[model samples]
Target: MRMFLKLNSLRKPSVHVKAPGVLALRWRLQRCCFCSSPQNESSNISVLRHLTSKIKATGPISVAEYMKEVLANPVSGYYVRNDMLGADGDFITSPEISQIFGELLGIWCVSEWMAAGKPKHFQLVEFGPGRGSLVTDILRVFSQLGALLQSTNLSVHLVEVSPRLSQVQAQNLTGEDSQSARDENEPAYRRGTTATGLPVSWYRRIEDVPVGFSLYLAHEFFDALPIHKFQRTERGWREVMVDIDPDMADRLRFVLIPAPTLASSTLIQADEQRTHVEVCPEGGVIIQKLTNRIAEYGGAALIADYGHDGTKTDTFRGFRGHKLHDPLEAPGTADLTADVDFSYLRRMAGTGVACLGPITQRHFLHNMGISIRLQDSPLCISPGSAAELPQRLYSAAPAPGLRYAHQPEEDGRALQIPRPAEPPAPLLSSGRHKVGEEAPSTTSGGWIQRTGTLAGEELRSTLREGVIGQA
Candidate 1:
């Protein structure tokens, strides 16, 4: 592994290692470590100065408000600055890991479409489509469906806010050289089509997509939404806020607002002993919109991301140059994210829709025939790449879970959480269990380990073959 230094304005400069063969595993491990130095003065002072001025004028801001300003504030937000994907960028996603992941998802979509009576016209939409890798693979697989590609009126819509990324998506989808010509007054839906022969459009919001039968894909999308952090205190839960450090003058710090609000009221009953909890209204709002769209217009969504089903814990962090950095260090230079509370998404999904399998991606892919695909089609991936795939897929102990939930207003419409024959053993060697052995019940401090390994596998299997009715 060859390491190099990447310096930014704030915090101690980080040493990013270029792990050639095992980049995925190395990057993920480093990200989870949360090992980075304190905040330092940044080179990009525009956003920082703007934030400071705002805070000084209006007082401290919520984590969600800070995240939105730093990440989506048109002029200097992180995503607005440039593309942050692939090996040289901040982080690599699963679609970028291997084409196989997308292919499996494409196949899964086809199965669902068939079950949905193969609607004559339907939309294939993706949210936060980074570099268009996943959708590209999906279109390729759809092309293999012969008449299905030609007969069915399948239009592609990408729900992306970044202008730079939208241009990248257009290029990937259309093959023709494309650039975003977004007008200041016009809505951000760029009209185009893929080389695979599907008409495509780009939108800044999900609501912009035309309402109809649709298949929505949101991989690693919800995690990026802004989250509100709350800490349990003697006076009840206090909302976390971002403020300038009085001592450092240039650094940003986390401060709690002592006042209790309506938002913190519900969380107080969840747990009194827990230290911290995150609530992402942005993510919840998106889920509600998606579920409402599916229920009203007729469609289904597949969400794959790294998060616990319902566990309440602080997962807020930052990533830059594929390494973990202090989230509060740099304002808009690094990607700020928190784990998706799938349970919250389920609860907020409202009535008339079913939520299925917050199952592990490992089991979902395994049931989708990932292992067999590698063995049967050896030429699909090189040996070097193949060796790294499993480690990347299972590197984070239990990989990100996959959820396949949809509305049941139409015939044969259902959500599945397949039950795997056996649970997968933990991949990380953390003094708990060896490979292929059952995980230990409790840790040294009497902390019970609620491993999602087997539960994920079983959920995947159940979704594949079984049907769970609407609650």
Candidate 2:
């Protein structure tokens, strides 16, 4: 979804999902290790029933609560118990497509680590590392650059709540080298070492990760965080809540409360412009944590998710079997997500960190010399698949599997995909720049962030070409 360029080849004719919130559908590459809802419709009942019990006791629940209980209830929650990734699951991530995404990221990590003066201790902390593909790719990069990391003590810390997916990450990354903690109550529930002797640890939350000059990565992670949906009313803003539909015992519906709830009153900005907004306090809290660490101890965080910069409203959506579905229907049977508001994340960061919101995979990769990388690699798409998509969806000069569904136009400008009947979404254009020229920056938005004072002059100059600026 983070990639604004690549819209999935829709299965249902004329049903194109809007972007920068993309869910790519393809013939398949890797089977996602995450558990998914069984074909049996009865399997979703437990989550639905539990929600009804909570609602009956507490009245209508906020959208945030609905998401939390439905996706992470610890008992019948979707993510807590499902394998919902890839072609067979509810979604597929950029990492699953090709090594370029992760490899470029790995290179960025090394570059940033160097910028941080090459700390003796390096921690690669990733949130929601599905099947461990991204981190595995990064680790390989680290090993490949033996001398660059030779003197640094490196570790992998993952903040993941899913026990089943944790097992998958362990099997893929550490194989026989990892083990569950003897005590279930430990802050780190699982611990392991890779074949190359790098230690890895897993935690249910980010608060437990040790503070250090670390590199933080969250790919397709923030959008899944529960968001409080609000609608601007004639008098004021009202929080959208979910309640049992009076006419149907088995269904849920959205209701606008007459008065603002604690969330609507506190989270909504008085200067708000959007008629609707989705705010994720959890995402804010996580950013605050990362920024504080960046400010205090010196680290960086690169968050990749589909989001708009203070521009979009009403992007909460659901996906089941790779197509749009009613978020309120069937409860835990689908994957519920909202577009990340990068502007809000900047507000939480509080100017302490140099935050960059969105650098399209196109810009970021091109800036990272992906053209050279692809030329040296063997990965390729079949002519059959290539012939199916519009030429603009792909540039004449190809980067293997880089279709990430978006292609730069002939004029070298990024193309914005609009939803049917909706205006063309505002282009997620990073402000302009070149070497020694001041770059335009809005403190309220952007994605890739490098913290600390040592962002490096050369790094800044090179990155400025792609709009990766120094604050």
Candidate 3:
């Protein structure tokens, strides 16, 4: 995970990481664990010095080249060995919030698996299964449904770039049910453990994840991939870059360069004003490949991220702990993310795999029964006991509870709490679906809209078959 670091020609200073624990510990000692000051100030200085030295040695270089070096630098790069999760980390993710979030997603997976004909062996893979709470909640639910868990023969796969995070996940999942048992005698969920009584495999990249009948889940995964940001200029959309100077440390600045060809058609309307457009070519490529895999093989995928309805503005920013920060603060230390492009995703998925959403995390989860699960939890009404409840359940918990995912609207700002939406119809016609002008309902007769076209009589016959199978 090499990051491209850069410095602006007009920047006051450059930011760099002197040592891993120094900046992180400074915040801890101050009890401002969420502060971005140390890394931002330090990174700016380090980057400025590195750039100045580089320019002296090799002459002037493009901002893009410099950023590439800073982030991906072999020895002192940020992403090489970073653990930016939890209260002391750069940012928190959905699975870190609560078990219900992952539990509901697990339920969603069950339905998807059944829709996919209940393959004897299928991989339930997650991208950055943060803190493993989501997976744990999911497995907890799986444990309850003995038939579903046993029948599917679920093999869990995780693609995590951070080895530190991988260990955290393994601790929560592969150990004995210590957390689930009595508090007084609770044991730590051991690392290198497998509570499933089943093996779990961890990999660094999606390409390494074995292909098969699989269910793909990526919550807040797309945004972290490096994005190419372009602002509409008089000439055309120019790419955004960061320039750093090693000598003038503690400063980082954003700059733009001409990129006539790479500028997207979507930026044409914003040409009158200097509107910024962001694109993650890497994330798009990954989506294309994953969609192709799902289409070719029998499977489903759900991607939840903070992104826009279309490719429009530059939605890139940085974060430390729970608060937002100037994106230019730290080269590699601070968490950098941008909005995902659902339009691009849908186009990539094509007809092979049905891409139901780029829907808001709220709406998607609501439709899939997150709210119901939340309401049923014992802690919902009795929430005042622990402030940790908000951080753990609503904010970033490693247990099975409520979780958060980002929702970026058109203006480029993100919604704090994702509101749930109605779930998309099942991708394949489950025997449960009745395709007809009249809305089909669950046997309990709950209204659900059907899109496109399917034979009405055939749909009803299929529904009846499901009813019979249940009986």
- Top TM-score prediction, candidate number: 2
Q: Which stretches of candidate 2 lie over 4 Å from their true place?
A: 1-40, 379-471
Q: What TM-score does each of the candidates earn?
A: 0.74, 0.76, 0.64
lDDT of 3 by residue, 22-123 (tens): 000000000011222235556545655676577568643443354445444544444444555554555444443344456656655565454334567767
lDDT of 1 by residue, 225-299 (tens): 888877666666777678788877777776667677666775444634556678888777787777666655565
TM-score of 3: 0.64
CA lDDT, every model vs. true structure: 0.56, 0.61, 0.45
Estimate the overall C-alpha local distance difference test score of candidate 1: 0.56
lDDT of 2 by residue, 289-317 (tens): 77666666555676666566778776665
Put the candidates in TM-score order, highest first. 2, 1, 3
Q: Residue 464 in model 2: shift from native, Å?
A: 21
Which segments of model 3 are wrong by more than 4 Å? 1-79, 176-193, 244-250, 258-274, 379-471
lDDT of 3 at 321: 41
How accurate locally is residue 126 in candidate 3, as Cα lDDT from 0 to 100? 82
Model 2 poorest ten-residue lDDT run: 428-437
